[model samples]
Target: MNITPSLKKVIGLCLPLLFSISAIAQPVRPKANWQNLDLQADGMFGISTEKAYNELLKDKKPVPVIVAVLDGGVDINHEDLKNVIWVNTKEIAGNGIDDDHNGYADDVNGWNFLGSKKGNVEFDNLEITRILKKDWYKYAYADTTKLSKDELAKYHQQQKLSRELNDKLEDARKNLDLYTKVKTVYERVFKKIGKQEPTLEDFADFIPDNPMEAQVKMVTMRELPKAKNFKEFYAQSIIDPIKFCNEEINYHLNLDYDSRDIVGDDYNNSNEHYYGNPTVNGPTTTHGTHVAGIIGASRDNGIGVKGVANNVQIMSVNCVPNGDERDKDIANAIRYAVDNGAKVINMSFGRPYCTDKAVVDEAIKYAMSKDVLLVHAAGNDNEDLDKKANYPTPFYNDGGHADAWLTVGASGFRDDQTLKADFSNYGKQTVDVFAPGIKINSTVPGSAYVEYGGTSMASPVVAGLAALIRSYYPKLTAVQVKEIIIASVVKVNHNVDIERKGKIKHIAFADLCRTGGIVNAYQALKLAESRAN
Candidate 1:
């Protein structure tokens, strides 16, 4: 039930904003593992992983690199992921004491900052809701004439966000009712027609006896063709959206709801870090499991999807939640990963707002000092990040940015005008590069595979590539790896359509990102080898 930052803006307006049901029904690529294919040989804008592995890395032995997945949670027991899951060799499993004496006890895999002995924090409020909850009493009835400029601006911003949140809640409730009624209509019609799973032909053959049945029949006929069967369409279109709406009403936008009590941490203290339990796979593991599979799912398992990197250990650091992640948890997660020997940390979650950016900034610096590369999702909002800021950015408050950080945008499976994912956020200065994110087939919970689209999926592609390079070229610094990846991108020399504000604008694909190209695993590896030599 996790939502990307970009999807948060339009989630209530329509169905789940990440991937449309129609888009899911008809994928851009026929195969799930098209992201690893070559653009020239396969006609898809992939990272050329197969080419790289066959041509260059055929006989080369790779040193296992630790890549930390900082997300909601991960299914460590997943068959495709279990082999590659990082095990803390120094720590004893199921022991209450911190055997390694690193403040975390029984952290055999990684740490969960959103949990304690009580339970894991499943759902939390958004950053905006938290902000309003803390400051509404201070500014709600204040005299505008006496307020300072910054204070007045903050007040107005809060007011606008409050209105937007309320509107989205109302929209969610309406959408929930509409979808519930539609589901009921479909169920009644299906029962009356005596079909357990109806097809388009089945719907066409049956005659509706009532107005509700007639309406259901029309919708089923129109949508059933887009899906494999009636049950799938119902689950994806109706059940999933209903769950999202319920999550929004109960947690994300609910001011009274607080999951921090479960954590039992000093919420006011930004530096208090050693309080979370060792439950890395929290309540939900779908989002984190998918991200882990993209980075380093077991490649030689002969089942499920092959990950981008072969010789990598994925350390699951559960910090993100169904809603916005807290800055403290994020900062602690970064530090934990760095301290635990993670060479590359993949952060596939983000938000548009930050309550304490300085703490996270300090943690970023800490990771940089420890020679850790951080790959982040630019966002899914389809907006220019230069104008609108995203949290956990490389840029610091004092001025300079982190050299080891790479912000990635989502690229589609084509090589033409639609190369850039329509929902991917881009910036000539902010976004470092693009990666194969659209219709990405990756591992989910219970040994299954699914397709997801977003910059969230894109970031792990680059992270896996980074891990690949670091594994082969162990001497390359994090900053050097960042430079090599950016310098060796597959340059797009054509125009692409990007929606700005409300209108679509045709712009040079190069203008969207710093490199004006997509991340190329083969090219990046070639560059790393040359530099290593």
Candidate 2:
């Protein structure tokens, strides 16, 4: 699949009725830069990016900060991102030699761990599927009597995950069928109406000539008011959801599907680090491009959306695939970013399981030794992470947490019940703070801009604020920066609506995260300046 739909899109498939109703009653679109707006000055729950730049950073000379975006892939050549894209100054481009002698040859930009000389791995199996596939033959037909205690536990887990995967795959197949039928109906309606892109007025005035026409008309009339045109509705409602289902069936849940050969690395070798190609922008760059733009997309550029941090270089370290990223790859990516002088690393991907967490834990410790801060996204599962585990966590096997790590949840633009993003994963002990992630406008592939919602979007917001702080205060340590950001959060002291166990519940906003508030760039800068003085 050339297009890799995100996990949020899959969740949307499960709640189509709720989303459809919301679409029918959708409000006017917020400003493109609403995520950067100040809460006090603009009445939007943003990071106060503009106010900080205009006031605190107007006269101060900023030191350039390198922030590594460890995601799927980034379009380094994006018009708004080109100037801010990090360049390996010592290495020459297209020389077919390891110019910097860092094991990666001709790495002028950054490296793509997901690609080899053949091509990039656009999609791969999820962690659960990989776990099931690894021990399938041994336990698929083994007798329970022959298994030892540890082996029996492993076998039971395998069986449970197997059943879950089968059930999910079946649901995906059914959703695919349903979306395909709806798409066909939409096409028939459009063909009958003789319009490639119908307006709301066109849909409102549309009269049914047949049973199928009437059915589609009813659907479109309920849905078309929010969409600007039929093409937008068709793509969002039909095309993207169908693609998400296909991704689930063909790659994530398919044990027979393997793309590791494309990388040509020894699957058993955890020590192998210098194997991937230099193609940083893989087949799909939508997710990574949007993430990079969120952190540092050339603030002075007249076109496209403004990024969070200024005077920062975004290093593209492509490691994540469409599905769950591997532990070995994540560990290597963190080490690579830290070795290459990345002061802060943004990891916007996570899964529920960790096959080998020791490697990742060691990598995070390595980052801490180098005084590098790591910011991660609380996953979009909308669960409490204090009870459930998320991979690449700050808490190591030994007991101590990584002081340089920050876990972020998604916050929205409103101060009402919707302040916390409905899809954000939360935990008072696990998540550090919330940031603007709902309907955030950022750069995508081909110089385009769009709004996307996820904890993936929220992680970069905190990472950007960290970069902004580092840019102004060069003397602050990574731990100090992390502390300042958390200590200076804009506190929220009211109840907010959150969905738990498939039920809407009103909970204190303070209970959602450790900071009990949203990230504020302006406040963080003030605290950093005070500490510097």
TM-score of each: 0.91, 0.94
lDDT of 1 by residue, 1-533 (tens): 22333233322111242233223223334345878989999877899999999999998999999999998788999999999999999999996989999999999999999999999988888888898899888787889899999999988988898898888688778777776886787788779778878777788888888897787777666655544346656665667777877888888889889889999999989999999889988886788999999999888978999899999999999998888899999999999999999999999877888989999999999999999999999888777998888788999999999999999999888787778887788999999999988767788888887666778889999999999999999999999999999999999999987755545678999999999999999999999999999
**Each candidate's lDDT (Cα)?**
0.84, 0.84
Which 10 residues in a row give candidate 1 its minimum summed lDDT?
A: 9-18
> Once superposed on the true structure, which residue ranges of model 2 sit more than 4 Å away at CA?
1-27, 208-233
Candidate 2 local lDDT, 336-392, one digit each (tens): 999999999999888888988888889999999999999999987777999998788
In TM-score terms, candidate 1 sits at 0.91
Report the error of model 2 at residue 104, Å. Answer: 1.1
| Predicted structure with the largest TM-score when compared to the true one | 2
| Model 1 root-mean-square deviation | 3.5
Residue 64's lDDT within candidate 1 is: 96
